[model samples]
Target: MTDKVTINIPVQYEAIAFKTKALGFDMPSDLQTGSLLKTLVASKPGGRILELGTGTGLATSWILSGMDNHASLVSVDNNELLINVAKEQLKDNRIEFICGDGYEWIAAYKGASFDLIFADAMPGKYDLFEETFALLKTGGIYFIDDMLPQPNWPEGHAQRVEAFITMLEKRTDLVLTPLNWSTGIIIVTKTSNKI
Candidate 1:
């Protein structure tokens, strides 16, 4: 067996997970990914952060706890029910939980560049990679996880991931690396603002 140390789920996260299970939502970010988010947010301090999918607020809790007061997070979800549950569980002034279509929301959003973005929603599927990349500040990091080979993945899902990776590889403005970690995270950093 591998000697991977088990990280304790914080009580807040446990509550969120409990709620998620009660709602039959089993797709929240795993502990490894959550921990990585915490670490990433912690390093950014007062930077602006965005999460595309606010599933049960489990990952939002992790990000909020790691961020300072000066930082702000905008997390969006299309499901009103899920967004409400997450808002209730994660009562934080710094986080703006939105319920709407992720694609349309990003399409209309003219907000400042984000220092870090967790594209964890349907948009995270890389359909809007170029638009999302443009939202990132130069030197900003974009995280897309749940990429590890999943037995439950629908047929042809792997092909989409492969095509996305290939597209990223050809980009000259950003540096992309696929980390073979928990869910095969593709970490992208915008090296320049040019398209």
Candidate 2:
């Protein structure tokens, strides 16, 4: 009963998966997932949000579009190339960009939980559940993308992903939902009223 996620894509699979799907070529995250994120922020107006693995600032833009004026976002990424793209794509003061492994920074952050969290940096064997739950406030939202057919993922990772899901379901104060779209994102809601 372990969870697992795959991150590898075969050429034949890529053909159908990325063919004519998003602004030409292929978008890592689909519009449906992006729009869902935006909607989450809009509904949770004024919420503090965190974007993990901000690739090229695409998701960052969507989060901004979904959030209200009072809300802010902190985006993290280890890729300098993507960070540069994010810098050019975003001009808002509310959005702060950080370049590094999310797990390292998260280890030092324990002040308060964020309202919304988007996890996109699924480095091999870097399941950030500990850091994610630690920073998530009660009633906050946590979204983890890329849980299916992990493009180039190591073997048995998909099983690990599933195990996490099973474990998530066992938590009493959290709600979990596995989306059936683009890579099967996991949505979790913390409701313990805790710090």
Candidate 2 regions off by >4 Å? Answer: 1-27, 123-126, 193-195
Q: All models: lDDT?
A: 0.84, 0.71
Window of ten residues with lowest summed lDDT in model 2? 2-11
Best by lDDT: 1
Stretches of model 1 off by over 4 angstroms after superposition = 1-9
Q: lDDT by residue for model 2 over 49-124, one digit each (tens)?
A: 9888876666676788788999989888887766666676577888989888877877766655689988877631
TM-score, cand. 1 vs. native:
0.92
**Clashing residue pairs, backbone N/CA/C < 3 A, model 1:** 148-183
